[model samples]
Target: MFKPLKGLLVLDFSQFLSGPSAALRLADMGARVIKVERPDGGDLCRRLYISNLELDGDSTLFHSINRNKESVSTNLKDPADLQFVRKLIEKADVMIQNFRPGVMEKIGLSYVTVKEWNPLLVYGTITGYGQNGPWKNKPGQDLLVQSLSGLAWLNGDADQPPVPFGLAVADMMAGGHLVQGILACLVRRGITGQGGLVEVSLLESTLDFQFEVLTTHLNDGGKAPQRSSVNSAHAYLGAPYGIYETKDGFISLAMGSVTELGELLACGPLAAYADPASWFAERDEIKAHLRDHLKQGNTAHWLGILEPAGYWCSDVLTWQRLLEHEAFKELQMTQHVKRDNGAELITTRCPIRIDGEIYQSAIGSPKIGEHNDKIKQEFGGVVRE
Candidate 1:
C-alpha cells in the first residue's frame, strides 16, 4: 500500500544470487527494477537450479527472486545495445552488479565510470573478495566463499568434517549487506545530492556474519570453536543449545539456565553443575543429560513441560508442519503470482512492512526481454553509439 520507492529506478546488471537478491529487495519496496541481461541466455540464474523444479521454462529460483521486475535483454558486446543500456544506467537512481573485479571495468561500467555518468546514482557491487586481493577473481560463488571464509568450521560437531551451510549463506548475506549499504547511500544522496559506491564481497559478508563468534574466539586466546559432539546447534553456546531427538520428533533448545531446565525436566544429574561457567566448561556433559532426558518424551511432551516454565525451547518443524501452523499462517509470508499465460508461482513475500502494510507485488518475473518495447518507448532513449 505505502510504496516508499514508488518512482525510483533500479538497474540490476548482476546474475545469480547476490546482485539479483539486492535488486529483488528494491523491487519489493516498489522500486522499478529493470534487469539487464544478455540477449542470448539472459540472467544465468534463469537456469541456475536449486532443484529440478521449473516454472515457465525458468528455474523456481529465477521466478522467486526476479519477480516484480522488468527484463531488457541486450548484447553488451554490440555497441548499439551497450550504449542503450549505458543510457539506462545514466537515468537510474541505483545500479547493482556482482561481476568479477575487472569485468565491469573492462566494460566501462565500474563504479568510477558510472559515478561520472550519473553522480546521483547509488552503485552497489558484490565480489568474491575485495577489489585488490590475491583471491579477488577466485569465483564469487557462495560455497567457495563459505569454505574459504572459515564459515564451514563453525557448523556441525567438532569431530565431524567441516559442514557448510545448506543454504547460500554467503550470497544472501552479501546481498543483505549490499542492500544496507545502498540504503545508506540513498539516504546520503537524498541529503547531499550525490551518491556513493556501496560495495560488498561474499568473503567480507561471510566473515562479518561470524563476527560474534570470531570476536569471542579472538578474545579467548584465539582458540578455535569446539562444537558439541552431539546435538550441536551453536559452536559457542553452552549446554542444551541444540536440537535433540525425542520419542516422536526433535526439539530445539535455546539459551537458558541449566538448573531451571534440570528442575523442569526432572533431570537429576544436572543439579550438580549449578555454576554458570560449567554450562560452557562442561557443556557436552550437560547436553548429554538433556539429550537422554529429552529422548524419553516426544517433542510435544518436552515442549509442554518446558514452555510453561519459561525455558527457551521449540519443536523442530518440517516445511509442512510450519505451513500448517496457525502462528506461521498469521504471518502471511507467501504470495501467488500468475502470468498472463496462466502460469503461476507461489513464493515468499517481502519481509518488510511499511506503515503496517505488507508489500505484495502482483507482477511475476518476465519472459526474457518482456518489457523491451514498452520500456524503450517510456524511457525515450536508446541512441546507437
Candidate 2:
C-alpha cells in the first residue's frame, strides 16, 4: 500500500533517542531514512544495559526505536568521507540531527552548508537548549530539562524533596515536536517549493508540557498550585479519592465531587456516607470511614464492585500485567519485529492509525555502518546503487 511519505529521502544524523525516534517515524511512514553514525561504536543505545532480553552485543532498546532505516558510518574528519556526505545531502529531502549546539556547523554539514548543496533540504535539529540560549552549549539531559523546567518541583509530596519523573518525558516530547516541525515544513515546502530549517529544543519542549501550570499562573494572577502528594490530589474536600490499599493489592478510587461520592455511597458499606454535605463538617471521620471500608477486600473485588457502580476506579497493574492485558491486544499497541538473526521481539509501533490500520515496517535497525557499501556505491560519483 502507498504511504504518505513514500519516495522521500531522509538523512538521519541523530543518535540515541530524540533524533532517531523522529527519523523512525518518517521511515515507518515510508520515507527512505539513512542513519549516519561514527566509526567508533555508533549510537550509545547499542551498549545500553538491558537485563530482561538476550542481545547480540547490541541492546534491545537500540532496536526497539530504530527500526525501518539504513545506517552508514563515515569519518567526517576525512576529506573523502566528507565529500561522500555532501553527495548524500545533495539528494536528501530531509536531514535530522540532535547534537550539541554547534557540532554540525563544526563538521561543515550545517544548514548553511547543506542548503548550499540542496536549497530545498529540510534541516531538522534537536538540541538541549535552543541555538542562541545561554544553556545551548551546556550538556542537556532529560533529568536536567525536567529539573530546570519545574517538573521535579511539581512532582512528589509537599514535605519531600523534588522527585524525578520515571520516564524520559523531555526527550520524547522533543522528538514528537521535531516530527511536527518536520511535517509542517514539508507542507510549507510542498506549497511554496521552499525548504527551511526546523528546530526543536529539549528545554522548550519540557516547558511546553507544563503549559497548564504556566497558563494558569499567568491567568490567575500568579497563583500557583501547591505541590501535593499524589494521594492528596482530590482529598482537599471530604470526597474519597486516592489509591486505596486492598487485601491483596491497590486500586485507584476517585469518588470526588458530591455526586460521585453519592454514587459510591450507594454500594452497601459506603452507603452510610450518601449525604456528603452533612459530613462536610466531619471530613476526617468520613474519609477514615471510607478508608476502613476499602481495606475489607482485594483490588479485583473493589474494581469489580466500584467500577461497575459508576465510581471511577481501577486496579493498579504492574508492567507485566499491563503488557499481558486484553486491552493491549485489543488496541494493537505493540508489534513483533523479526531480526536479522531470525529472532523477534515485541516493540511499540506508531500511535497514529490510518484507514483503521496501524502502519508498520519490517526493517530492523542497521548494524554500525551496515549500509556503507550501499551508500558508498550510490554516492561515490563513479558508482551508483
Candidate 3:
C-alpha cells in the first residue's frame, strides 16, 4: 500500500488512550512511531485492563493501541536520559503528549521549550480541560470528562441518572481531533517550512462531538434536550428514531415519515400522526405505539417490510452475530498481529482504506525499551554511564 507518512518520525509521549491513539493512526498511515516511557514501568496503560484478559504480561488494551510502534524507556528525571530524549526530540517530526497542564512544563518538555529544540516539530497536546482553567488539574479520565462535558446527559432514559457512554468516547474524540490538528500543522509545515502547536482537550472534543444537538439547544431558546420516554435513541430526533424490541430480537429505526412507517408496518396507531411537528410533540406516544407494534413481529419480519422501501432501518445485532455474518467478513476488518516471541493477538485493523488498499501490519507492540539499543545506534544518542 502507498503510505503517505512513511518517512515521518512520530514520538509518542502520551500514555493510555488519547495521545497514543493519535500516534496509532499516524503509524497506521506509515509513520514510524516510538513510544517514550518511564523506565520503571513504562506506560501506565500496560496495566490498565478493560477485562481480566492480558497478553505477554500486559493488558490487551496496551497491545491494541500500541501496535506498529517502538518503545524507548527513559526516566525523564535522570539528566542523562532526559538529554538523550532531547536528542531524539530534536530529530522527531511530531510529538504527542497528554500529561496534565504543568507536568510537561516542570519536566522541561513543554511545547514552548521543545519547539526551540526542533523548530519544525509539530507539538500536539491533550489535556482534561485545557491549559489554564479551574479544571486544568482535574483527572483527564474518559468517564470524568464525559460527565463534566455534559455528554452523560445525552445518553440513557430521561428518568434515569446521567449515563456515560460504555466506551471511552471522550478520549477517542480528543485523539481524533489531535490527529486532525497534527495533520493540518504538518500540511502547513510542508508549505511554509514551519511547525506549530496543536492542542485538544477531552472536554472540548466531547463538546464538539455534540455540536449538532448543542447547536439546536443554542438556537431553540436554550431548552434542555427532551429524551423520548420510550425507545429513545437520539435526544433531539423524533419518533421511530430508536431501537424497538421485536418478537425474536430488536430493530433500529431512523428518521422517516410516521404515517409511511405505520402503513408499512401495518401499525394502525401510527396513522394518527401525519403532521411532522407531531413527530416531536407526540414522539413519546408515537414511540410507545411503535415499541408495542414492533414487539408483535420478529426482527426479520419487520426488516423484510422496511428495508425494501429504503427506509433507514436495521436489525440490531450482537458482536457474535455481526462478526459471523457474511457482510462483516467481506470487510476483512480484523487482522492477526504477533509479538517477537510468537504470541499473537486477533484485533481489528485500522478502519482506513487509501486508494482501495487496506493497511495491516504483522508487528505487535514492543516491550518497554525494546528498541533502545537499535534507536541509540540509529539516532547516535549517548546516555551518561
The model with the greatest lDDT is 3
Candidate 2: where is the Cα deviation over 4 Å?
Answer: 50-54, 229-241, 266-293, 381-385
Per-model lDDT: 0.89, 0.78, 0.92
Going through the candidates in the order shown, the clash numbers are 0, 1, 0
Which model is ahead, 2 or 3, in terms of lDDT?
3
Q: Model 1's lDDT to the true fold?
A: 0.89
The TM-scores, one per candidate, come to 0.97, 0.88, 0.98
Q: Write the per-residue lDDT of candidate 3 for residues 65-112, one digit (tens) a residue.
A: 999999888889888889899999999999999998999999999999
- lDDT by residue (89-189, candidate 1, tens digit) is 88999999988888988887888888888999999989999898789879888889999989997788878988999899999999999999999999989
Question: Which sections of candidate 3 miss by over 4 Å?
Answer: 383-385
Better of 1 and 2 by lDDT: 1
Task: Give the lDDT of residue 45 in candidate 3.
Answer: 98
